[model samples]
Target: MEKPLMIALDFPDLDQVRQFLAQFEQTDQLTVKIGMELFYHYGPAVVTTIKQADCDIFLDLKLFDIPHTVEKAMEQLGALGVDYVTVHTLGGFQMLQAAKKGLSDGAKRAGLPKPHLLGVTELTSISEQVLKEQQNCRLDMNNQVVSLAKLAKDSGCDGVITSALELSDLVKSVGTDFEYVVPGIRMHQDAAGDQNRVATPKDARKDGASAIVVGRPITQSNDPEHTYQRYLKSWTLK
Candidate 1:
């Protein structure tokens, strides 16, 4: 599988997304993530529009629900022909298995390939202190992430969306074939924003991340196309 550098289209609306993507040449293809903020506002039509532009989509809603509900939702999303979709590992083993089945069934029905089902371990904005104090999680942050990765893999997920800070440890625990789709990647000079645990693109690649999802550093840059190319180069050559 290609280790794609995914640009998170975190814009509030489709217009902003269009304006930002307009910087790239029409023939240039990109792997993009459409998260809740934009998707919720425009629904699946946003995904269709991006698909029409020949971009691979990673729908990052991080679905967490009852097993049947999540399964049904995955079935619907699979028909969208997205390259990847996220499900919260906290949904447990049964839900994970059901989601996998739903995606496969949906893809078969739609005559498209199954999308990669990525489990979300934990949000990058969460810190050790927050985990222990607010979430009442007793294990350390790394342990908690590894534990989730194990569950995700054992339940049949193809990969996990984790912070780059934990990618190396997760790979050690789950083995390399279990894809590490890392987010919270910041450039050396960029602000971390709400994400507490962040890594640079080169560091993420060095840590053995299968792919990295970048948002603000590229999307909010003064020159989005230039910044995106810089990130892509770092992932490819570093």
Candidate 2:
């Protein structure tokens, strides 16, 4: 329960979000991720609703652009008081630094602590084939993920969103001082769906992931709260 667990709330609207969250008790201290869809549909207002629910927010837009533009955008996003925000690791050092500075500056203006800046490495949907043929990246998937993670660590990112398969290598390569928020998590009974490199919560924990994101396994379950609690139990098991 103490370990960070982020549930991906990929719903497109606030009403559905409320309905889903209402299933949980009021005392629950949930940490949820708001990806591009909800944010695009409802804008900053979505963050307000999440905050009102007494939940920690992971604003996972995966911002990627020139340094100046990203910096400015992060400034606005940071003011929403989210616990974490993401940038594309491929954006390079200057952009990452700009994101951190912009986030800290905006947070200060709003009298809130700066949200952690997470760099998104290779997405879980990407495989070796996709990396080599589609993106045309010379480095293999694991090497590229580790490389981007190291760059992110040096460039002021507090953590990275990498798959659990690369989590151990990330810890070994980048050191434990950086956070590793792994996604593409699926239990044994869950379908892989579009994910290419998914792992169980136990695998992620064993590999030294600082946090983990679970979407459909819980979100799409017949009983979301029960599924979430069950996963949380497994996540903490010795």
Candidate 3:
């Protein structure tokens, strides 16, 4: 998408999505994320609804399974013609390859442009403590994210969904050829909520993030359109 910010529509059902988007316009050229909750409940029909609004879609299911199974599922998702899709980078090289293949094959068959495949690295909600104790990894937070990012590139994925705090290392290690999408964004006044590695949109931009994902700050705002425009200005202004 031309815009660098994508809103995460974390709403539960189609009605809420329709209502939220009604505040904006087709000219907004908005890019939105349809996460597991929305997709799992509404299925592909939600994609059709989002499309009707003339916005770009990032289908963030973060698919992780056996290669063949993920591949088949991606075939269906690709046919929806969304702008981006995600798989877990921990799923390893062969699975990433299968995801790319499945998406391409499905898009080609349906005569649609293939969506970019982004691998989800360690989630921003995860802290170093969680990385060490819960996941039992020897490398520190940055190392693990970079490792997974390298694997994504080697596996032929287009980009990675990672945290803003880790962006500098990724840009250096993974380089400019890959897209670095940062989430868990929050303003200085906003509560951290469940996220541990949150950053402001300006921090993401200065760190060289290709895009940023914003949720509640915009979605739950009292005046969502005004809030969105504020964020858009913040994101674009130098």
Candidate 4:
């Protein structure tokens, strides 16, 4: 599969998604992400719509639940034929295994390729202080990310979704073959917004990230296509 630059479609409704994607009508083979906002609003049917448009979907539901619940949910999500999906590594070994099993079973039933199961290590919005104070995590940020990434790999996940800041350490700990789908990507001039740990596309590439998820920098730009092309160039040129 091609290394993807996933554009997070963080719109509130289907029409806004349509409007956003319309800008890329001439550009085929896009890898787009459908996060909770649009997924909850439109359900699985949005996947079909995006498929029809010839775009690959990375369904970013960030599933975190009991093993049974996550398994059943993965079953349903896998059947949608999305290219990727995410689950929280914090869910533990049994849950990750169950999720993987469900994805396989669902894909087998539907005769579709199983989506890449990405385990989320931590949200970019979270800080080391926040993690220690609120979640009672004892390790520093890099150690915590590496630890969760190791658990994800051991429990059958295909890769991990982590901040670009953690990519180098994660690769060192988990090995280079492990997929690192990084979020919190922003250009130097862009605002950080809610994300605390951010990196430029060039930085993510240097850190050996497999892919990067970019949100407002592209979607909210005055020239979305130009910004998208810039990001693509940043990854492709070096």
Structural similarity to truth (TM-score) of each candidate = 0.97, 0.98, 0.98, 0.98
Specify the poorest-scoring 10-residue window by lDDT in model 3: 22-31
Task: Name model 1 segments beyond 4 Å from true.
Answer: 26-28
Off by over 4 Å in 2: none
lDDT of 1 by residue, 1-238 (tens): 2898999998998889888888888514789999999889999999988887788899999999999999999999998899999999999999999999999998888999999999999899999999999999989999999999999999999999999988888988899988899899988888989999999889998999999999989998999989988988888894
Clashing pairs in 1: none
Model 4 lDDT tens row, 1-238? 3788999988888888788888874546688999998888889989988887888889999899999999999999989999999999999999999999999899888999999999999899999899999999989999999999999999999999999998888888899878999899988888999999999989999999999999999999888888998988887667
What does candidate 3's lDDT look like per residue over 1-238, in tens digits? 5546899999998999989999886524899999999999989999998898888899999999999999998999889989999999999999999999999988888899999999999998899999999999999999999999999999999999999988999999999889998889888887777899999888888898888999998999988888878877777889
After superposition on all CA atoms, what RMSD does each candidate show versus the true structure?
Answer: 1.1, 1.0, 1.0, 1.0
lDDT string, candidate 2, 99-194, tens digits: 999999899999999999999999999999999999999999999999999999999999999999998888898998989998998889899999
- Which ranges in model 3 have alpha carbons more than 4 Å from their true place? none
Positional deviation of residue 123's Cα in model 3 after best superposition, in angstroms: 0.7
How well does candidate 1 score on lDDT at residue 31? 90
TM-score of model number 1: 0.97
Give the Å shift of residue 170 in candidate 2.
Answer: 0.8
Compared with the true structure, the alpha-carbon lDDT of candidate 3 equals 0.91
| Clash pairs (backbone) in predicted model 2 | none
